[model samples]
Target: MAHLLEGNFGQGSGFNECLSEHVLLTRFGIGINDPKWISIRLSLFKSITLPGVVSQNTSKLGWFIFIDSSWPSEFISDILLATKDFEFIKIIKVNFYFEYYIISEKLIAKSIDFYGRCLVSKIDDDDGISLDCFDVLYDLRGDFFACVFSSGYEFLCQNRIFKPSNMPFLTMNTHFDMRSLDDLKYLRIGHHRVAEFIDKERRNLHVQDEGRFWVYSRHKYSDSRFSAVRKSIVDDKKSRVISSADYHHFSIDFSLLQEFRSQSALLNGVPNEKTWLRQADLNEEAEKIYRQLVSMKRVIDEVGADVIQ
Candidate 1:
């Protein structure tokens, strides 16, 4: 994630410029210095995101987090302290949104030079994957291809609900396979709309409905917290109340719910217990502009597949 930076939204969509401080405050609802927003985000990062990522069965992966350099120093310190125990979890501070792509390209080039192939994956700050996601990705690595782990559970935190979601092209990470540094095209784009860039023949859509391989959570601070489209997908009648048994099944720490609840109390007394989506005219307008600003687009030129030596 670019972490509140204005990145390339689409090929023709003009959102590459760094957002003004005024726009940031309006788009995100809370300023970066807001204590309530920081508390909620940190709570989710620690309680929900880190546990499953740390539980990965394989050590053959690197998790890079791109956070804005202008974030509050105290907040950055908190993040560093939280991730201190995990060596593979790197916190990279970027001055601008587009800088991450430039730095990531160098990182990918180094990987390919050393290993002859690399797999680039992506995940959100508030989402997680199965303990074996990296293991599966490394096992299925190849040249000039893509993979999506389509089976996952979508959790609504306020309501404490878990729904079985079966969507096409759902992935935690490793959506693109890079056989050489020229494969940088695959790494430059976001995970949502691969079909627009990669042809149907080269992309592999892995659907494993029998097992849940990822966890997508929705909370008040989420970027899509006000999105009705997201609501329709995960808030179905088929969703069930989450329980202790499901916690173990999803590789989530049992204490996550309590931690989130306590954090909610700190933020706003947990008022929206029944609904995570807060409805308001201003909120709707902000959400609309936010959606328009942060869109999927190809960031680099396409590089053809590498020739076998």
Candidate 2:
């Protein structure tokens, strides 16, 4: 029911009301790497990343996705294929190889209108949120400069094995006002660096620890713990995959991902992420929704007057 519709992306309440409505920025980026590596992530993204977003059970708002321009033609093509129906899903590409922090900085900076009163939420392309994630974040983020939401599922991915960390999960959801982006300490750093600088700006921060608003796919490529000793400081994750057992909680599909890896040349470094990505292995029913997600042209088109209802 939440398919992307054509027209202007504005709330119909007049200019002032639209201005006052809290805008959100959801930052999702796939770090640039080799062609095959990029391909692997592309596959996972189709399954794990995009769904939890487009299906949000709330008023339509702002969402920005940053991607690498260096990714292969097929990879890019698939991105276009899947997102063709969602007009609001903006794809801002970093044209060139990699500069981790710089790329992230630009993604966040450009996606947001710093002059406006905006609340930005960062979700990795590999992770996902529940259907009502935006609604909850928007409601609870009132007057807060920063906030951290509790993660429901942390797929502890290490050495290519998975151990689900459910209860006693990680507090990984982070978001803040556009004004907070003015700080020199974190504005220019990588997306994950906000944790280091967040403490300084938490006076009006909101903390949600009761429910799992999103799924945190913990892996090497995930944008957390760059400054920590061993990426273990995030929500105090002290150890690696705690006794790998065949546990299933988050929506993950391991076989399709493995098959893609075995078929392609992407087995050197990246670990296999086994999470429910509904779009990965599409049946007739799944394929119908997959095909309905909008095109790149629709994604670029703007919502000018009426609010998304």
Candidate 3:
């Protein structure tokens, strides 16, 4: 699995990739390499992401973290220091125009070269998975499909609350069930779209309602629109206070989360005020996209899928 922290991905591809890059930069307002943003993300990665992987039942899995090549020396040093203790965690530096899928292909090649099979997965930079997640994946290594642990919690930082929610098909792994990458039609599609692109027979959706294995964090630094929606929904729901039990399950350090919040507070409002204006532009663009999607759906409903095709 990999975590992208300001990694220059999809730049070598088509126009869509360029638009994706622009959108991310516009969202952050402060540039991706801003000291405060890097500091917060690295802190989160160490306190949340790394701990989960380190405490996994099995130590055989590799966690690759990608960062922008232009990051300052001190930022690189901090990341290196944080990850140095874990031998399995590798830090990769990519230039401005790196193709994201090449990393996936390279990972598959490594797995096939060493073990003759591949099961690839990813986690968000601020998310944590169950301690036994890798063990579960290893058991199903021989299968050819996309695997998902759909049930999880969304933790809102402001109130330190945990609301039971089923995330949309994230925390996924693709088992190609083949030794080579050639003609790989379903090679690491977006987690949300995996079910759509892959047939039902090849998709394994494991619903874990009893023990919520994954935790999705919602804080200010995350994309605001989705986080705001989740916060509003969580406000009305019956939520449980986060406790030691939850942290122990994910092997996350509670103090680190506190530290992250403290640092984020200090960095808030430090960015250029004009940069915040981009949020308005982003909202406008989002509305346009939503309207287009609604129009498309209405057309589909009226004319049917065959006619649209």
Candidate 4:
């Protein structure tokens, strides 16, 4: 027989204990002052749509759950148990926002390691609005791509993508500047093409004028640089191979603006005059980055203490 259970899973013991303990602790202890906090822990597991298949006299039944996007280990475990006893299973699709670590953890554990390398940032809109940016950053020394995003979806740049109401403001790190549709087209045409596409047609219709222009310039800026960096990283015998864990730690370490900008310039190339001046004008950007780094470090320290205890 096959059974399926869905909902918040509530706060209680026994059958009502479908949710993670971390979630219960946060929901009750922290309360709902921050809606984003609630989404961070719950959104990952809530969208799971699984189909359970069962056969008669098959007590030794095994099932495969296919997820469109990678899932965290804890979340996956919960889901497997939550939807038990399925012969053939498939997770039609899933979407992730501002949670690359969770995605990375799941993929690395499953041995399906893939990197989204060679990405650039472009402006998406302008109202003198600052938005969180995400891009794919390749570590030449490590020869791995670290998907870094803004720790919080805070607006810092005039032309950038805003964090969706339902999504976290995570960005990826990259040396390349991807601002134009043409640049993205080149990426899609290359060997790096994955099933994921950004739906440029839709984006073009809604994205603002200044944002579009900046996107065009960004593509021009990053193309040659990306090629050079990729070649250097690949050919260098001394390049370091970064593991998932290292990437996680690196994210915490480099979350600050001083670290991020310095390292970014070293890895990708120095920011152009316009880019530099623009960043300088936004005084709050640096402070926001610093706060995020500190917050992440605190989380790490707490987790470590808990482990030791």
Candidate 5:
């Protein structure tokens, strides 16, 4: 019984139990031939969207109806062909039935600003816009519309309506993470040289601190060459050189050490790290690991890492 309980007990079982308790199973008796009863139960779990209801900001309307992005295009095409039954279309419509049209001219304007293309065009003839112009514009924004449709469809399929598009057409507001090209160009070289110089010096200190009788042969050679390269890149007067000892000590500190351990655990089986360290010809796994540790520190600052634990 203990083994059975242990095997059966899993996340979200409590909610399932509550649902089963509230819903009278006897009302729809177990009848294998009665398809309508099955349909009614399925509909209960299906997401319902009403027209003209300005959904709350948190709604995840009709997104589960689309194919997964990881699925190959050919596979998706085949799925669409196989599931061409009008009943499926009706299901989608039932899930996302909207009575009132919501115009988003402002949203469309924003998309044009960020994407450098228009999706919505005026129907008036006096605008001098030809069908060719409309076609070209539509072609450019078609990908965007398709994405929206796919997301909407998925939401409906999952029985959820009120899922708002993050990039709503007709809204002129856009969000983007913009970084200067110059900043990106120097980031890799700057970080690499600095970390390498620090690591070598730390290793030499570790050898000396071990207090072996033999003279430190490795200590005779100055790791200063790497340090010099790093210093040369420091154009800002305020920038100062940080030693490997400083970083080593920082890593061992109670707060930082705890974070390092957590990050190391998180990265344990990630294949990308192995590929990056081995195949990418980047012989700086230690440096990469340290960089990730530093990034985790920043994340901890934004959202307390204790919460995750």
Candidate 6:
């Protein structure tokens, strides 16, 4: 299915010079005024995405995060507060007129002379890149204008359940003059296949089957072809718990995800588990609260925080 959209966008010049820095240009719900998406994005970032980034084994990289200025002051404030803990992340708020694509292209054009070699990659706010993702992409970057990693994990995160897909090709990481490519062909999930949007008429795309390079996530507010609905489930029976060896950089620290869920559940007055939340009776109870928060926060700018207070 991903292949169908292949060869659709413009290609880039295979100008791979030795890069001094690998920049991760990411869009964290820029221009998305929807409250539900903002809440879900915040939850995912606190748990799945940013932790993996900060834990990277290779330090030769910078994380550039984009958010829209029109977003609620409180929502953006929360993000800035969290980012304060990570010095490498640069926060850019886009104008009401700017979208993700222009943001990427403008950054790429500006960065051409800033570094000896620049490798740009766009990571979704809800998804995660492996710890070794930069190390692998940088080593294999060559002189190609872009590279699409054809392997990654599918994190089925919905209803407070954490399931990892037992298959590859679920997520890919594209970088090296890559961030601006988000402006090239389109939406969130499919935006990674940026080969089609390069200015060159014929693209010299470097495709590598590097498995487990990153992790893709699904939830009720996912902004893509399968918006808020499960669409990419390749196999239901193959789903299982994520293992220690599942990711290349570091295994998922469930403790972090637990904190987010626990807070949301407590806000909604969800009962504590007697034995385990997974017991048939209590199963999905907390998940509902978490999901409910996403739903209730859909209009957060208008509602105010008095409900939870």
Best TM-score among the predictions, by candidate number: 3
lDDT of 2 by residue, 208-309 (tens): 776666666554444334224224434454334423222222334455444544543434443344222212333345334433543433544565324332
lDDT tens digits, residue span 2-35, model 3: 2233333322232221111000010111225566
Residues 103-142 of candidate 6 have per-residue lDDT tens digits of: 4444454454555345666667778877776667667766
- TM-score against truth, every candidate: 0.69, 0.56, 0.70, 0.16, 0.13, 0.63
Q: What is the Cα-based TM-score of model 6?
A: 0.63
Show model 3 residue runs off by greater than 4 Å.
1-31, 171-179, 182-188, 200-210, 269-309
Kindly provide the TM-score of model 3 when superposed on the true structure, using C-alpha atoms: 0.70
lDDT digits (tens) for residues 88-124 of candidate 5: 1111111011100111222223333444532221111
lDDT scores of the candidates, listed in order: 0.57, 0.47, 0.58, 0.25, 0.22, 0.54
Q: For residues 223-301, could you state the per-residue lDDT of candidate 4 as single tens digits?
A: 3454444454445554344333322322212122233233334343422333212223233464456458768879879
Candidate 1 deviant stretches above 4 angstroms: 1-34, 170-174, 200-209, 224-235, 265-309
TM-score of 1: 0.69
Candidate 4: where is the Cα deviation over 4 Å? Answer: 1-49, 52-82, 86-97, 109-309
Candidate 1 global CA lDDT score = 0.57
Give candidates' CA RMSD values in order: 11.3, 13.3, 11.5, 22.4, 30.2, 15.6
